[model samples]
Target: MKKLVLWMVMAPVTGLCLSFMYSPSAVNHPSSKTGKLIISFRNSVDALPLELNKTYINSLQEPFKVTRLKYYISHIELDNTSAVITPDANYFLVNEEAPVSKTITVPFPAGSYHRITFLLGVDSLRNVSGAQSGALDPLNGMFWTWNSGYIMAKLEGRSPASSLPLQQFEFHIGGFQGRDNVLKKISLAFPGGKPFVLKAGKTLTIDINANIQKWFQGPRSISIATHPSCTTPGSLAKQIADNYAEMFSIVSVTD
Candidate 1:
């Protein structure tokens, strides 16, 4: 009994000594290396890049034009074993028509990243916290005045499949509370099909596939004619958001 007790008491001390001897103060003395990450968004199908102002056939065989496609992305995190890279400017609003808004550059700690994760919309806290600026600003025309919340995504255009006035269809999706919350967390592993190693001062550009056809696929096929718009919180909004959850895919990654 005494021998066993003595071993147990000494085990912790031995571990502590070993840890101190083998482990350097790595956290305090982090590697002074950082890199720039470039992210791009595009709408494509069948691996073919999409052309705006052009009508395309969905899985439902309905013709539609994507005049505008904008969405919010926030809280980007690059997964790492030793450290995570999260830039100070994490919120972004991506607009398809605006060439400049389609991509963003962020600074990150130099390291090997295994996966990339990001949020599709503002969190519950930000929604309830009142007005904000930058990507989450109300002047962006993505806010819902009646309910008071930022619109996570917007899909507006004309469609021959619609019976609505002028054959117009507008989808403004946003809800950051309760069961109808539209916030989506997406995780991408080696978005370039391999591990990304960031050099000390290099930049890596990645093409993101923002497939719009996915909006018509999911538990059910979405009809542009009947369901012209989904601007409120309910089953339709949830369903539409679910369809858009898989909108992002990695097209190319260049270091």
Candidate 2:
């Protein structure tokens, strides 16, 4: 009777110990606050889905028709109170003119985090690092082989809304060296939650709004006169990319 009781008590505890030893939490020793993160997308200025507005043809002065829109984001970080949860670079990419859904696991020191800070696009390190997968996948069409980098932002459309015909614009904004670097880092805060609690094995879905009209919001409709594509280094791409960086905002989170 004594041996049986001891076995019952030790079996579960022993299994749990071994599980923790091999878990990802063991590498960083995450606290009880650890949880999974869910991210979603929205377009704020206009209800237009980000997917529909990502192409340059979509940016013409008038007669806007969207044939296609796509891009990629890599090396993301989620900022919290006690620690920053940065996932592997193999994570997300915005493609096929569709808003994407992804779950990223961030290991923190264990505590509630009310807000998060992240990148609107990939960091310079991965942009310069050679070939990659997912968002970095060369097959995704966001990368530029001749220039040796990624197209940080892409928009296309045509409308009875503009004056130009067959207008298309492509903005590939990134250059680690010199006047065209377009990586954007953003921080968002949440109120009313004290040390936000993340229970183990649970997932939180967060909604992010990428304002589609943000590119043309402050400025007049992009002149159809500007260069059609960023085949060479110049200001057209830089201006549009800078505009695209300002398009993101946080909408909500579901735990």
Model 1 off-target regions past 4 Å?
A: 1-32, 80-88, 191-193
Estimate the TM-score of every prediction.
Answer: 0.82, 0.68
Please give, for residues 1-255, the per-residue lDDT of candidate 1 as tens digits.
999999999999999999999986434333457677788888774456777778888888889888888898888777833223333245789888778998877777787776777888877777877878777778888889999888998998889988888888888998888888989998877653568777878877777888888887766678997698888977888888898998788777777
Look at candidate 1 and tell me the lDDT of residue 190: 69
| lDDT of candidate 1 at residue 3, scale 0 to 100 | 100
* Candidate 2 whole-model C-alpha lDDT, 0 to 1: 0.57
Tens digits of per-residue lDDT for model 2 on 122-180?
66777688867655677877677887777665665554443345555444555544676
TM-score of 1: 0.82
In candidate 2, how many Å is residue 121 off?
2.6
The alpha-carbon RMSD values of the candidates against the true structure, listed in the order shown, are 11.1, 7.0
Q: lDDT of each model, Cα atoms only?
A: 0.79, 0.57
Clashes of each: 0, 22
